[model samples]
Target: MDNPQRNDNPWFMALYIGGAGGILATYILIGFFAARWLVGMVEGPRYWIAIGTISGLVLGSFHIVMLIKKMMGEQDG
Candidate 1:
C-alpha cells in the first residue's frame, strides 16, 4: 500500500526543499527587526543585531528540524 503520510506527488518534495531558504530568511529578518525594535538601537555599535541573528539561527534550526521530521513522517503524536 502507498504510504499515507508522504505526499503521492514527488515534485512537492522539491517545493518544500526550495522553500526552506525563504523560511530561513524570513525567520532571520523577523528576529533582527524584533531585536531592533525591542532594544531601540538605530545605530552606533548595535550588538542586538548579532544577538537577533543568532537567535534567529537557533529558531530556524528548530523549525527546519520539525519540518524535516514531518516530511519524513517521524512526527510523534
Candidate 2:
C-alpha cells in the first residue's frame, strides 16, 4: 500500500503552507481590528492591542497544532 505521507507532492505541500499561513494571519488581523475598534469606543489603558495580539497568536497556534495533529493522524492511522 502506498503511504499517504510518503508522497512528496509539492502542490499539496504548498496548499498546506498557504492555508496555515492564511489562517494565522487572518486571526491576527481580526484580533487587531477588534481591539482597535474597542479602543476607539473606550479611552483608557492602551494595552488592549497587546492582549488581542497575544490572544490571536495563541488561538492561531492552537489551530495549527490541531491541524497538524489531524494530518499526522490521517497519515499514521
Candidate 3:
C-alpha cells in the first residue's frame, strides 16, 4: 500500500529546501545590518565587525535549530 503521508515529489523537496535557504539568508542579512548599525554608534570598525559576526552566528544557530525541528516534524516552542 502507498503511504499517503510520504512525500515523494522532487519539486516539493526542492521548493522546501529553497524556501529554507532564502529564510536563513534573509535572517542573516538583517542581523548583520542591525548589528552594524547598533555597534557603529558606540564603537570602532573592529567592534562593528565583531558584533556583526557574533550576531550573525547566534541568529544563524537559532535559525538552524528551528529548521531542524521543523524538518523533523516537531512542534516549535
Question: Which candidate has the highest TM-score of all?
Answer: 2
Higher-lDDT candidate of 1 and 3:
1
Ranking of models by TM-score: 2, 1, 3
Candidate 2 on 1-77: residue-level lDDT in tens?
56655546799878987899999998888888888778888964579988887788889989988987776566544
Per-candidate local distance difference test: 0.80, 0.81, 0.71
Give me the candidate number with maximum lDDT: 2
Clashing pairs in 1: none
- By summed lDDT, the worst window of 10 consecutive residues in model 3 runs over 68-77
Q: Between prediction 1 and prediction 3, which has the larger TM-score? A: 1
Candidate 3 wrongly placed segments (more than 4 Å):
1-6, 74-77
Please identify model 2 stretches exceeding 4 Å from their true place: 1-8, 74-77
Kindly report which residue stretches of model 1 are placed more than 4 angstroms away from their true locations once superposed.
41-45, 75-77
* Model 3 score (lDDT): 0.71
